[model samples]
Target: MTEMSSAPTVLVGAGNMGGAMLAGWLDSDTDAGSYIIVDPSPSPTVQLLIDKHGLRHEKAAPSDVEAAIVVLAVKPQMMETALPALTGMIGDDTLCISIAAGTTVSTIQSFLGDIAVVRAMPNTPAMVGRGITGAWANAAVSPAQRDAADRMLSVTGPVEWVDEEPLIDAITAVSGSGPAYVFYLAECMAEAGRRAGLDEDIAMRLARATVSGAGELMRRSDDPAETLRKNVTSPGGTTAAALDVLMGGDAMQDLLTRAVAAAKKRAGELAG
Candidate 1:
């Protein structure tokens, strides 16, 4: 368990993901005073937390206090624009946790020299606290510091440590960009339901709930997803009938492989 109250967390850019983390921290054992959020146009989530908890909200960098943990939550493209102000708050020992996709450790080190940094790639589903994050730490981070990063990341959902920093791109491709794929699956399923003449709202509700419920089941159960899938899919059943067309030519697999490759390419471009 992480001692959330022991050290203050400063988050830069309370956008979708950063705000989700702030919400999660608010619900955690962490003290309200331990949290700080920085963003230009704060979203509804940020506003709600500020009004309810009186959590620290600043339009720019907070200078009065030095944070034990600083989260760089701005987008990779925006980091260059927003990072200089953050340097003032980064004490020699302050641990930096960056959720900026495609912003490498080297890139951040250039902005904030020698401050320990842990790079993380987390998906959008973290908004609901069902997200998983894959993180990488540069050699400068202490073992204890890395552990701290893992626990903090785990607050959103599951956390995995990557041995190679470049693997963050793979993580981006597989998981960071993975949520959209799941969402699209739900959309497609709903559309298919509508085509089958079900009412539009009912079709959408069924698709969303079924997909979400299956994901929850996978999360809570001991059995593998394949096992659960097979359990529901009877021989020559409706699902199996659909599977025959979808999986027969390995169509879904091939399409997803291409999609992941495209995501990986874009990740590289962003890193570059």
Candidate 2:
């Protein structure tokens, strides 16, 4: 295994998500000199990373260098213009990882040649180091390369791998966009609290703390979420009353199913 300090990891974009991963790596004690940050306009946060790490910064990918891993974090729409510049940098042994949504392994391979490619979907919470990633690799990736990809992505959060590339679209629907769904839930909950006569500020604070605390509990607990809900609910109580509305005819479940389906369909559309 290559030492984290000596490994050549080229980051293609140091935007929010990418910068978060870089910060996580730095915090985890990976050497500052390990990264080559390629961004046309570095954000203030990324500029700090450049200064702290003594990282190599370039407006475009350098032609002569070989990287152990090249991470592509640009927007899907910008991929066409961005990818061609790095084609020369991708050698057969290099593991190329893409965090852009709706971009496929085949499309990435087409741009960079037949190199190992891993397509990853990571949500926004990664900015705070709470993100989760779903990844799928093409046939060219060896077991070692897959492990390396997992290690690199794990810097942001837990990494889950799907056997089939298409499954990444489902992963996209679930976890990639899941944070927004949770945020919207908090918004609605706060509005409901306001309707229940709480002050707007208090409502928002309660909603935020409730959602985040429950999420942390879910993360730390071994019991199923259903059990956790049942434990909180009393017979014919306020919690039960709310559950009746939410669970009535499986309203929440059906609604979420439709939402996820729509998201998956849109993801597939974007892939094409």
Candidate 3:
């Protein structure tokens, strides 16, 4: 196995999600020089890292370099064109991991041909290292190769392993698309506060803080979320009044079920 710092880990895009992953790796003290970013329009966040570490950022895939790992961070729409252009980088030893939402492991293997490949679905919360990634590797991957792949992804967050390939798509529907659902809740909370006559700015501030604080509490507390939730809800009080509207007639539960189902269907469609 190659030493973690020996060979370059090529990152294929450096936009918001890509940038976040890069920052997390660096923040975790991974060798900065170990990254080679292949991005045409790298955001300022990526540029900041380049400036600090004097890291390599190539407009196209380097023909002479051998990457220990090649991370496909580009958009799914662009993968068909981009991966073909990068055919030279794939080799027997390179372990490729893709963070693109809809692209499947087989689709990646179509371009990579025979190298080890892992399909990963990570949520936006990875920006803060509070995310969980669900990943599945093709059968060609060895045990040591999978360990290396897991270590590489650990730069972002925890890894959850799966047996079959299709589960990654379900993971994409859940954790991959999960953050936006939380953000929408915050939005609605702020809007409801405004409707109840609070100032718009204050309402927004409260909603953001509450949502973030609640997540932190859940992380630290031994109590399950349901327990904490019940602790706030009184039998004949304001919290109960709010829960009556949200939980009554299975409103929140049904809405979330439909929402997740739609996301899952869309993930499959994209993979197709």
**In candidate 3, where is summed lDDT lowest over 10 consecutive residues?**
1-10
lDDT of 3 by residue, 40-95 (tens): 87999899988888889999999978888888999899999889877887766888
Give the per-residue lDDT of model 2 (tens digit) for 81-150: 9988998777768889999999988888878898989999999988988899999988898888888788
The top-ranked prediction according to lDDT is 2
Question: Over 4 Å off in model 2, which ranges?
Answer: 1-7
lDDT for each of the candidates?
A: 0.87, 0.89, 0.85
Q: Best TM-score goes to which candidate?
A: 2
What TM-score, over all chains together, does every model reach?
Answer: 0.91, 0.96, 0.93
* lDDT digits (tens) for residues 1-272 of candidate 1: 23532557788988889888888777874468878788878889788988799888899987787778899888788989988888778877788999998898888888889888999998888988889999988888888888878877888899999899889999999999998899999999999999999999999999999999998899889998789989999998898998888898899999999999999999988999
lDDT of 3 at 171: 86
In every candidate, how many clashes are there? 0, 0, 0
lDDT for 5 (candidate 1): 28
